[model samples]
Target chain A: MMGKHAQNRILAYSTPLVLIGILLVFVAAITLTGDKALGRMAAETLIRVVLVVGLWIFVGNSGVVSFGHAGYMAIGAYCSAWLTLKPQMKSLFLPDLPSWLAQAEWPVLPAAVASGLLAAFVALVSGATILRLSGIAASIATFAFLAIVNTVYSNWEGVTGATSSLVGLARYVDQWVALGWAAAAIIAANLYANSASGLALRATREDEAAASASGINMYRHRLLSLVVSGFFTGVSGALLGHSIGVLNPDSFYLGITFISLAMLVVGGIGSLSGAVVGVLSLSMMIEALVRFEQGISIGETQLALPSGAQEILIGIVMILVLILRPSGLMAGKELRMPRFAPRSPDYKTSNN
Target chain B: MTSLAQLFFDAASLGGIYAMAALGIALIFGVMNLVNFAHGEYIAFCVFALIVPSTEAVAVMFLGKAPAFLLIPVLLGLGAGAAVASEYVVFRHMRKATPVAMMISSFALGFVIQNALLAVYGGRPKAISLWPDLNTPVGVLGAQVPLLQLIVVLTTLLVVCALALLLKKTRLGLEMRAAAENFTMARLLGVRANVVITGAFALSGALAAAVALIMATQTGVADVRMGGQIMLVAFIATVIGGLGSLPGAVAAGFLIGGASVLLQAFLPLEVRPFRDAFLYTLVIACLLLRPQGLFAASSAKPRI
Candidate 1:
């Protein structure tokens, strides 16, 4: 048992250390690429890690599914984008915005936080109505919220561009900024996952009725996690939007929602490490495919499949995983050093 | 009144295709407890099937002089084969997993398929046009119905009736129903569970092929992106009616279809631009109130 525990400790640190090392190497490679595309990828990937880790907080702990995170990301992106782009443009694009919002141009950090807070507030409001339902109902409610948000984004022309918002926001999402935010997101999710309230959330997730009988406020715990996660997702949206330097309602469509979801599922649902692995691996694979097609062909045929076959392949992979290894690659296992955890008591260890 | 008839006819034609697609989706959900998010891609694959014979730029190899009715059966067979392969490769393995896993996998499958399709077909929505009038109307009940609409409605009715009879009178259909109701019990009775379940998926694929034809003819268009939009409607219709009930799904599909038409007719012009909003809101309301669905036999989370 001691040997197994020691092995677990070693295994945990090894992956992250390797990951961090790889991230640095990629960062170097991107810098070497001369162009900033690699840097943008790194920055966007960092943002993805943040959002996905936020997802891990609730999905991992509760084992319940929620689709509303994309909506939160949408809110965050537009909020920050709206702020930093310029007030005159906000007036032009977001004609329906309140007088105050129609005339505003904020800096990077404030705009980002405001976006997060806006999403978190929305989460707070939604959780009150939705958190009551357990399992599929809760999942469905989240989807409903997603649809409503998407509709609003699509139609609410005064603040949103309705279809297009070519905001000339300077590229503020440099690597340093993204790195700091990613660190914040990681720390926030990690702390929340292990906090006192986090424990209660986990308990509720395990057995809601039992957790309630044990005096855990199931709604409160789920809501708390959702609010925190919503903030991160919102920030991710802001950063991603800024990195791309263009924004549109269509950008956050169901397609992105599905890919984000697949990333979490394919990586390993409950683990932060899994989210990282999923994003990095999928991104690289896609990049390689794109690169491969651009470089050479197999005889007369392009060796390329169809346009959306990547999504199909992803679906096939997801289905295969569900059938063959339902728990995902990493399952619920955490990736952390032994130093991060408290030592088990002698009695507990000796008995085991 | 003339324009109104045309609009109704158009909506009905669209709805007919939607209903067929929904039925195909519901059929699999009935037995497997899966929503089959890859359904739209599978439908698109059928169009690809149609495209392949002529894709080689050789018209003579295909039915040059005659309408290639052979392509229809060939495509259905090929689609069924692909569907079964996907089921065996991916979904069959995860049938017993958690909902989160299942749902996520569906999303992944959708993404992979969409991107791959985009890579191959390009971003352009291809015109899968057909001969004669697809959208032109004929009068029915003071409102004009398109011939295509009539064909679609008639196709759905005939298919539904035939499927119902298959489920009732045929041994294979009965075995499928038995398996859907209680797999372990059916298994205990010496039924081959794997064969029956896979057969259900195969049947679903065949139906998808049939629906693809209606879809192609009704719209007078075919594009890879067509499945993404229509699949959601199938999902909403299936869930609102009842997850595993065929009759319920069909009823819901028509009801939702009628509702979408009615919304365009009755909704104030100010709200006319947001037709999808009204359509989805009704679906959401139906789902919220009838999570068990209007017609589903109450069962706990299906083992599948």
Candidate 2:
């Protein structure tokens, strides 16, 4: 039999292994059988995985519900567009861009990385002020941050094309690229979750007073996690812009914010596995509903629901799931191999 | 001088609507820690109740055609009933969940309600002419104020007075106040949890209806998204007013409204459209200055 230390090591490795396996299987199935539409759908789902995992990093570890992660995504998406769009097009559409940004043209990878760093930097600056507050106040402050970003992006005509769609972006992100990012997000989330800073943050999340008494600086830990969360969220946004081949400020608003939070909460907000699982399952359900909305032909009878019924049904389904499983499907537990299984420290009954 | 009078009237009327919306949000947050993201959809549902249920481009008034006497109560009742129904169907079952989970559930419910409205009413903003005469301007304190503005202001005062009376004089109100302070302690003192919670939902729902009527009358267009921006502002107001404090919410609502109007009036034409950006930055500054809010309730602080 393995020692406890050996088991703990196996448990750590196995959780991420299981997560990567799930994503790889998804990519393989879609690549082998799916057409272009399905390929696009797969790419969207993987990008959501990246986004949700990024969200899970801050929300899960700090226990702060941030409504502003999409703001970072907005920043990332626009920053990548600024860097990668043709110099000529930039001059035509974004005349007010700083001289350096207007003149620069970088490759996709560098642009995406830079996009993440830019977002991370913003998160750090914002968190310094916002993290001093706790609970609902912090949540509201993050929302204000999102609103500021959204309003500025939607109104700054010369640089962002204002409310109009920013078009002609190179569609550089595909299923393969999205899969890589999703995998990276999961690994990064798991690594951070197990790291010392992540542990300190989680401790603060559990009990702020006790954590602080033990010499943990709640503000600093929360800020670090927010930066990490913002970085990955920004990358996901870059990937999203590249995949859609266009950017619109409206796309980063309330709709995406709610949908991403729904996915994260549905899978479980407590574990890395939960974040990945939530996105995978919900994406599949949504796709299935979309296909159903389009109708499935059975023996010459095209059985179809009304066009918008899918959204209503999905909403009801989410409400039901929350009612039944208040802690979400995963309930904060990571997937582990049977022989090396250990009870999750976080898996206590909520004080409902 | 006339411009100043006009600005004050504009600010007050807009502030009245926002104050009502903020009260609805604060009432629910007081009893339950959950912030109902679906409150805006309640307003939308009420607006749509006025029109004939169809995907037609031009809306022929249904309930809206009724004279003011019949139309007002019916719409308010519908709003209250829908809110109560949502609480019973969705929120009641999820009381044991985390606040974050409950919030997402509320968002999902809002999504369902919005899409349902879309299915019945189509995705177009329909023009419904109800009480168009109310749009006529009347000279008030040297400002040409719309009659509807006076009505909105008066309606808000009436609601606030009525709510204060109900809370101060009635047993139900007493229970609600007790629950809002400390739900567990209230229950231990024999206060019925369900009754207080349900009552809060009903009142909140009614407030949402009041906002719907004012908004529909003011704009004359029933867009599915009409309530979203106001709801967001009210939500911010609820937070800035100190979470569970009713008076604080109303005050903050008016403050935000005044600020918004002032920004729009004073800012250069080029920056006028970016008014919300300036407003939200002030919100951030307010939070940093007083994280518990401008008027922090005793219970608003994080418990050590």
Candidate 3:
């Protein structure tokens, strides 16, 4: 009954809408349960959605695997901690902070925004040089960037508490708030994937020589994607900090980096839907594993996995998944409504 | 002047360890184009192999009690065995997958290995006394140098020379070199893919074992997480040396090690704690200056 263009437009928007809808339903389910632990799990899962989707903005489009987005998250997290913690608490804990940062305090939302902006600024600076290199070289450079960030943060006594955990952060990121951010991240990732810069970056990812030959500025587009990616990654860091109400440099190091990357790869590294789905599925599995580790009620007795069994099992599962589906579960395809008829040959390829 | 000599010995010893680690990584990457993240776990496994599995602060010697003549070869064999087993179990099936997938798999494999070790050994760092006598300092050029450090340098030199000879003179080496240059072409030329791949894994694993021995002797402490920092530095060296270039990997390993030591020694006390930050920044700068690496192999260049 509708024109083809209208249908196409709806289809284009449907992926993000479906993703957001899925998140909303997850949040509703958690809310209905009214259990604090379930609420915490949902919130953590949504935060990971933000982190992975942020990572996908650059990695999915540019085909550059980053081992450093966690660095941006660290930057955002500490930035929020510096801005939002009580002035009195900051003075006692981080006495070496400059007078301005020492005395100033801001609301949670603005502090998070500022944290994201700060992370974006760092990405812009670092990516300017890093994006010049292509492929694995770029990946290594991002890793170096992460190392630099970690080393600095771990040693910076006055600001980051120097390897000590910074506590007393406002735990404002409940499931609903996290749901809002996750939806925002999905929408942003969807927009970027369809944008000109994103398309150009994807072109380079497909074939750098051909993309350059076609006049795409690989450096600029890559940088833009990285900056946007850095922003959301930073916001996620802030969310993680607020959710747990603690911050540590070690938390944002290789563990989060690899785990988040694993989620992205498992979900399908190429599509927005993959990013969201990857986070949800992997997070749920992890939660279930944790519960099992705690002890499952069997008919006769409680059966519990060993304490570290979850990590080992998850790793094995990841390997099996990669072996079975190299391109990931979504295989780079966005979630879409089922189509009944074959498309006409003249129809333009739908944006994935 | 004595202090300067001491610094040189310190740098060289660290550099030697890093060189071995880098070579291990470079060998695998040359053959398979896979940056085996599990390489670090291999090192940890070898170190852990030297001790009885326990959560106690003081490690009970298992293999560490073996005589030097028997211990070295056994540990090296264990490293090689583990590497080859992983190749057969996990990596062999992934030959057709993209580099990214293989990389993630390697990381997952590492995660599994690390956690398995954690579950068995527990998380506490154990004091491991390998050869306490090796730490005795002897005067050299007016500077006292540890015997272990001198041995590390000599062992690194010996390994490099031996590997050079093997690579230049052996048939397996020729096949490996060919494969590193062009894997498909080497296959077409009748190179046995399994043999060459398995060989590289073996050599790489032995090198990891050597690094583990050196670290265990040097630090006198075996932690589950010990291999991670060295592995990261070695990975960066491997890239900086040119992804597939063996000699370059060794050189960059030494360079990074020397740079790190020098930075630690020369930087002001206030900035000393940030030495790794400075080192990594330099790594980024080096990468930016030469994206193809300081010693790029011909195969590293894109045909397009």
Candidate 4:
């Protein structure tokens, strides 16, 4: 018979493993098709998985909705563009880069890591002050951070091309690469969620007064989560820039911010599984809708959805889902393997 | 000095618009914990209501053809109708959900509205002249201000006074105030929850309609995304003013608008485009200093 502690450990890890398995299956299935568009869709979905999972690290644990992660993504994307682009292209488009960065051209892997680190550094500094405020105040402060980042990026012509697209990024990120990052993000999120700080932050989320009274340092835990969350979000941004081979400030604004948040919330913001599931489900629905818009043949008839019906339908579906399941589709429960042995009386599953 | 006077009028006019939008958000937030992200869509909807649905360069005026006396009330009613319908259809069922869920739902609702508008009217912004005579320059306090600026300021003052009277003197207003203060307690004390909530939505929607009319007149162009920028500014204003405080929201709205105008006027030419970045940074600092907000009610504080 398996020991309870071993069983509990298996349960704790099963969530991420299952999520990674789902991603692997998705990648393999798409690869079999060998279709470029399908490959791009799969890669994009995995990138979202990384983003929403990064979001889950902070929002799911701290219960503070951050509208600022996309700002970190912008920082990461720009930093990667600054690092990876050819020196000649940089000089022509982004002439004002400091001498060292202007001359330097790094491989995609190191640049991506460096981008994530830069984003984490920024998150640490910003979250230091912003995380002090609890509840909606913190949420708004994060939003302000996003707005500040967006404005500066949009207008910083010398560096960010000032609303113009920054091209020449190495298109190195494919389905397999995105899958690796998504798996890494899921692992990071899972490890963070099960960490001591994660538990402490969640305690604060559940009952701030009680948690504080019990000696949980809410600020420290929240900042830690934000930093971790920012890192992966930044990496995802780098991947997105590399995948598309172009970066624009507008791409990392309120639209992505809300959509990612929507995915997190819709998938059940409480569990790691929810983040992954939300991205896959929503992405698949969108792809299917796009395909439908492109028209489908059935028995000598062609059927097509209106061009913009997808967005309206998705919005309506989101509303319907919320109305039916307010807590989200996962409802804060992690998917665990079935236990054949009698359960240990002392063992309890962590809900967060 | 004349430039300063001109700046002042410009600031006040812009501030007045934000104040109105912020008030609309604050009203619903006062009664329900939900932040109505769909409020912006209501503004867009009202603006589009003035024009017939067509994907054309020039918008054909539908309600825009009506005289001011008839047009204003009809638009306000349409705005109110939209808000009430949303509240009844979407939000009513979400009463028991968490604030985050409700917020997402509201966002989804706004998305639906925006995309629906996008489908009906193509992506391009359409020009529709409304009260073009109001655009003529008029000297005010030794400054050449657009007549619409003066009108906007005056209309804002009139609306504030009328709202003040209604809130202070009307029975429905008292119930709303009570509900806003403490919904559960007010409900327990026999104030009808539905009536107060519905009244707030109606008032908020009418305010949005008023903003729509002013924006349409001032810009003479109606884009599907036009309301989004103002809505974001107004949302920031609502929060900085203290989420549930009506007067605070208005005050913050004007303050932000004034700051934005001043920053635009005074910032170096090279840095003027980055003015919004500076503005939002100040907003973060403001929140850091006073997380409960500059004008938070005592009840806003949690009893630990």
Per residue, candidate 1 scores C-alpha lDDT tens digits across A1-352 of: 4566666545554544545555667666777886766676678777777678777777766767877788898999988877787777666766777777767778889999999999889888877676766666567567767777887788776668777665776677876687778767766776676678988988877777788888988878888888898888888888888888888877777767777877788778867677777777776665665555455577886665444444455565566656676776677666554444455578477987
Reference-based TM-score, model 4? 0.97
TM-score of chain B of 3: 0.99
lDDT of 3 at A297: 92
Model 3 gets an lDDT of 0.93
**Native-contact fraction for each model?**
0.59, 0.95, 0.94, 0.87
How does the DockQ of candidate 4 come out? Answer: 0.87
Q: lDDT, candidate 2, residue A246? A: 90
Evaluated at residue A122, the lDDT of candidate 2 is: 98
Docking quality tier of model 4 = high
The clash count of every prediction, one per candidate, is 37, 0, 0, 0
lDDT of 3 by residue, B8-90 (tens): 99999999999999999999999999999999999999999999987777889999999999999999999999999999999
Residue-level lDDT tens digits of model 4 in B189-215: 999999888899999999999999999
Q: Which scores greater on lDDT, model 1 or model 2?
A: 2
Give all candidates' CA lDDT scores: 0.72, 0.91, 0.93, 0.92
User: Which model, 1 or 3, shows the larger DockQ?
Assistant: 3
- B1-304 per-residue lDDT for model 1 (tens digits): 4467666666665666677778778777766667778888788767655553322222122211226486667767876887788778667767678767766666666556656656655666555555446567677778767677787777787888988999999888898888767767788998787788788888888878877777766665546687777787777777777777777778887887788888877889876767777677666667667666788755535332
* Alpha-carbon TM-score of each model against the true structure: 0.86, 0.97, 0.97, 0.97
| Candidate numbers, best DockQ first, in rank order | 3, 2, 4, 1
- Chain A of candidate 4: what's the TM-score? 0.96
Docking class of 2: high
